[model samples]
Structure formats: C-alpha cells, structure tokens
Target: MASDVHRRIFDVVARIPAGRVATYGQVARLAGLGGQARLVGYALHMADRPLPWHRVINARGEISSRGDSFSETLQYRLLAAEGLVFDEQGRIPLDRFRWDGEEAPAGPAGEGS
Candidate 1:
C-alpha cells in the first residue's frame, strides 16, 4: 500500500535509464514534488519493487550516504555495473551521466506493450 506520493516518486525513478542517473532533487522536481528532495529519498527507502534506486544520487553528484555501509557499497557496485565510473573523490560526473528524463518507458519493463 504505497502512498500516492511514494508511487509518484517511484514512477519518476523508474524512468531513469540503466546507464544514466538523476539527483534526488532532480527526481523530486520531475515527480512534481519539487523542493522536497528528501521525500524522494524516504519514498525510495520504503520502495518494495525493483525500481532502479541506484540511479538516484545526491545533488553533489555523489551517493547520499545513509550511514549504512552495506547499502552504500551495494549502490556503488550497482552503478558501476551499469558502466558508471566514479572519480577519485568517489563522485560520478553528473555532466556525463545525468538523465534528461525525456525518454521514459511506457511502463515497467515488459509492460504496457
């Protein structure tokens, strides 16, 4: 029973492609929750589906550390598996990998076809 707000946020997150990423603020704005970036994070934390949560990062082009080293490491590995390379300071170059949110899939993979 995901709330409407969380579902909206998840929809925007699912649109982020495999190799591109979006910031929390960016996803929030796109989900029509502008200026509530933290809401995006909270929704994702409660997400149960296989949304591409790893594709969302902080506005500073780095993963938002949740103080859970395991999840943080898993996020880094997931992004790397999608061919994202981090700089020496462990930040992805947003200019090179940020999604423009123009090419959303019709629905989850294998749906709406």
Candidate 2:
C-alpha cells in the first residue's frame, strides 16, 4: 500500500497539467492535506522514480528550492520552452499565467484540456 504522504504527493502531481503550474501549498489543499505544503515537498524530495517534478513551482512561479545552480537554470529553460512567459525579472507572472486547475472534462476534443 502506498503511504499516505506518497499518495498525497501523487494526488497533487496528477492534478498538474501541461502548460500550467501549481504551488506546493495549492496542491496540498487540493489533496485535502491541510497545511502540509512542506510535507508535499518532502515527499517529492524522497521520490526516486521519474515524475513530472518540473510542473510544480513556488507560489510565485519560481522553481523549488532544492537544486544546484544548473538545475535551476534548466528549470527556467524548460518552462520557457513550454510557452510559459516570464517577466523581465526572470519571474513568471503568476497573475497572468497561474494554472487555475479547472481543466475541461477529458474527451476526444478535450484531450489537451
């Protein structure tokens, strides 16, 4: 059986979509995990297998705080390639680009939704 923390992390990751982003706190809330945003981060940190770790960011749309300098730079490059526009300050404009997590129901025509 999956541990509660692992399940919670997976639940949060599953909700993040391509071209969108979510903060650790937002994912925790959506997973009904209360104020355990740090727990979410910890769980992710312990994960060994590959997952969409890049789709998540801070509430301010910045990368997670646990990587080397090169990793941080790579995060920015990958996000930029995904069409995520950033401001002059190198910060993603959360107000304009925040992922609202309101994807349309999956269907033939809503594959990207």
Candidate 3:
C-alpha cells in the first residue's frame, strides 16, 4: 500500500501539466513536503500508477541519471514529445518551461486551501 507521503507526492505530480515540468524540489515543496526533494524522487521511483514522471527533472533542469540508458533516452524522448526543447548540454530551459504551480488546477494534497 502506498503511504500517505507517497500518495501526497503522487497527487502533486499528477497536477504537472504536459509541456511544462517540475523539479524534484518543486514537487516536494508543492506536496507540502518542503526540502524533501530526494523523497519525491523515491516516491516517483516506487510509483505503480501511470504518472507524467518524465515531467519531473533535477534542479539543474536536466534529467537525473538513472544509470539505465534506455530510461534516460526514453525520458528525453517523452519530454521532447511534449515540445520541451533541451539545450546542447541536455538541460531543459526551466525559465521557459518550469511549472510555477500558480495555475494549479487544485490544491496540493494535505492542504485545505
């Protein structure tokens, strides 16, 4: 069973719209788990449900290396499909594509308002 923490993390991740991305730290903060960026990554790694996982990246606007070349390649392709352009250094331009959560459709989990 998914813990409340993981559930909350997933809920926040679900709100990340396509064509925009969130950093692990951003998702962590939005989920009411501020400063728990690594936890956000762990929750995502353990997620069984279908999530826009590729929409989450590192603080450097680059995909975190998973050591699985296929997954890394897949992540790049997935983001590209959503119209995200990576620079020659493989960094997504967070300034242009990062989701600020201002247009959030719903509140993050565990928040009343």
**CA displacement after TM-score superposition, residue 38 of candidate 3 (Å):** 0.5
Q: What are the runs in model 3 whose C-alpha is more than 4 Å off?
A: 103-113
lDDT of 2 by residue, 6-113 (tens): 777876676566667778887777778869888877777677556666767887777866658886788777778778887776667777666676763576876754
Which TM-score value belongs to model 1? 0.90
Better of 2 and 3 by lDDT: 3
lDDT of 1 by residue, 1-57 (tens): 899999999999987878889999999999999999999999999997889999999
Better of 2 and 3 by TM-score: 3
lDDT at position 45, candidate 2: 66
- C-alpha TM-score for every candidate: 0.90, 0.79, 0.89
lDDT score, candidate 2, position 22: 78
The lDDT of each candidate is 0.91, 0.73, 0.91
Clashing pairs in 1: none
Looking at model 3, the pairs that clash are none
Cα distance off (Å), candidate 1, residue 53 = 0.4
In candidate 2, residue 6 scores what lDDT?
A: 76
On the 0 to 100 scale, the lDDT of residue 32 in model 2 is 85
